[model samples]
Target: MSGLRDLTKTKGDRLAYTATSSSTVNRRKRSFILSGLVALFILVAWLSGYMIDPSHLSTHLELRNLPPSLVHPFGTDWLGRDMFSRTSKGLGLSIQVGLLASACSCFIAAALGLAAALGRTADAVVSWLIDLFLSVPHLVSLILISFVFGGGMKGIIIGIAFTHWPSLARIIRAEVMQLRSAEYVLISRKLGKSRWWVASRHIFPHLLPQLLVGLLLLFPHAILHEAAVTFIGLGLSPHQPAIGIILSESMRYLSTGMWWLAFFPGICLLLVVRSFDTVGEHLRILLDPRRSQE
Candidate 1:
């Protein structure tokens, strides 16, 4: 009778284990599919930036602004340059702006947030300064800063970096506050670990999971805002190859029935932003220590 009871228990455990494994596998498979699509989109955008071999086209008005067809896949623009090439180059610049601005934001948010969480003294000082910066509308603030700093790519980078750090800073401050209360921190204190040592070894690692997510999420926003500032003629120089330049230039050609100038670049911008969000979000979920696949 005891042997029979053990056998029944074994079978129930196996069945439960099998169900859990199946569910975990299904979730991982779905995540991979979504991550792949986003990765492919980013790869294409990266390639578009410099996949050009200047060895291909030459100066010619004869082929200018040709419609999309077999010879030119994405059509041509007013300058007789291949729309495909210009798009790839324009996307490259936007990618540069996104990444550079994001790096600046990550560092700024981490330092200030961590500082604020160190104690009430540090928190009060940092909190007051962050709130002051957060009070104004971001776009207005960006333009105002640009007007001061010569209103070019440099201005755009600086302005975006300034305005975008606050959200992540606030989130990081909250995360740090929670982490400071965790038992491990108290244990480290009991063990005689220096405050800075404890923060580096214990607190920062826990904060990273959310910080990574915020950085990627901020990327798409940075790209869009950069393009907007550029479009208004207060950001990057008009002559530079940029999606905003292409879009702004298209307005003049609209009455003449040339819409491809705006349409193709717009699609590229949207897809790139979507991929950043999806892949960044999925990666964050995977990296989260407390998040379980099942």
Candidate 2:
């Protein structure tokens, strides 16, 4: 009877393990599917603007400031431009700028971080530089940089790229420092492997995950900062139908109760930013081995 009881308990444990494994797999599958949908939504939105002819977004004074209707889905702005088209274009522009700035920032962060982990001197110098940048308020620094660069697309991109790297650099530096002390790293060094060789083979593979997460995480901040700077008239020109420009122009008529001018674009911007953030978070969870197991 005892043997039979022991066997029964073992079978129950196996069944529980199988059930847990199946549950985890299902959760992971759902997570990936959700992430894909978010990605598709962002892609479609960007394409909607990018693929459309610029002439379609032109002003038509006759239809100006019309409230939301079937003819003008998101309503016409004060200039009679289609709010839908304008919002879509603005969003696409934001995504473009965000992508460029985020990539540049991530590149800067990765380079500085790897350098900092190279030696004590390099580490101290890079750390000091990071701190110096971080000391200044980000928005102020961004505006100053943009102003110096003449306040346009180039200015916004450069400003965001330069200002956003310090935090991510510090994180990467710490990660590299930890990886530098690992047994395999020491072994490779002792085996007379060139630093570059070990770095490319061992260190880089380990760092790729962190680098990607940092890049995606930076996207929303880049977009928001670009919009803010533009709104303040230090980022992009008013001629551009950027979300910032749209919102800034909308302010003039807000007293007249034209709320839709700001409402639709604001919501679109929020959704785009949130979508990027969600993608980054989901990627982080999916890539985390410990969480994946659970």
Candidate 3:
């Protein structure tokens, strides 16, 4: 009887484990689908903006200040520019800038993070730098850095790259610190493998998922900051159909009641930003071992 009871318990446990595994697989599938859809939307938006001709964005006096209509989906700006084209172009530019800035930032974070694993002195210095950067407000530092770099696309990208890495770096540092004490790493060292070899082979592979997620997470902040700086005349040129410039120019005409000028572009920016954020979050869940199973 006791043997039969043990057999029943084992079967129940197996069934429970199978059910949990199925649930985890289903959750991962849903996350992948959602991430893919969001990424597709972003790619389409970027391509639409990139493929549009500058002439299409040219001012048309006849269409100036027109309200949203079937012909002009986002309506027309005071200069008679199609708000749709302008917003698309601006978002594309923002995405481009964000991509470049985020990549650079990730590189910085990864380097510093790995360096922090080298020694106590290196860790201390990296920690201090991280703290120092974190102490200042992001916007203020971004503005100052943009001002120092003379506030163009280059300046904006550089400013964002420099400013955004501290937090991610700290995360990477902690991860690397833990990884250093991992049993496999210790065994590698004991086997006379060079630190560089162990790091590149073992540590870096472990860090890749974290880095990818961090890069995606950084995109929204980079795009928003770029827009903010450009809005205040410290980012992309005003002549460019940047979202910031579009919104900034729209402010004067808002009193004149041309609402679509700011409204559509603002909504588009928010959607794009939110899409990036969603993708990052989804990727985080997919990549995080603890969350991936849940």
Q: Among these predicted structures, which one has the highest lDDT?
A: 3
RMSD to the true structure for each prediction, in A, is: 2.7, 1.3, 1.8
Compose the digit string of candidate 1's lDDT tens values, residues 185-285: 99998999877887788888888877888888999989999899898888889877888887888889878888888888899999899989998878776
Candidate 1 lDDT:
0.83
Provide the clash count, candidate 1.
Answer: 1
For candidate 1, report its TM-score. 0.89
Which candidate should be chosen as best, given TM-score against the real structure?
2
Clashing pairs in 1: 48-88
Model 1 residue 75 distance off true place after TM-score fit, in angstroms? 1.3
Distance from true location, Cα of 39 in model 1, Å: 2.4
Order of candidate numbers by TM-score, starting with the best = 2, 3, 1
Backbone clashes for every candidate come to 1, 0, 0
Model 2 lDDT-worst window of ten: 195-204
Report every candidate's CA lDDT: 0.83, 0.90, 0.92
TM-score of each: 0.89, 0.96, 0.94
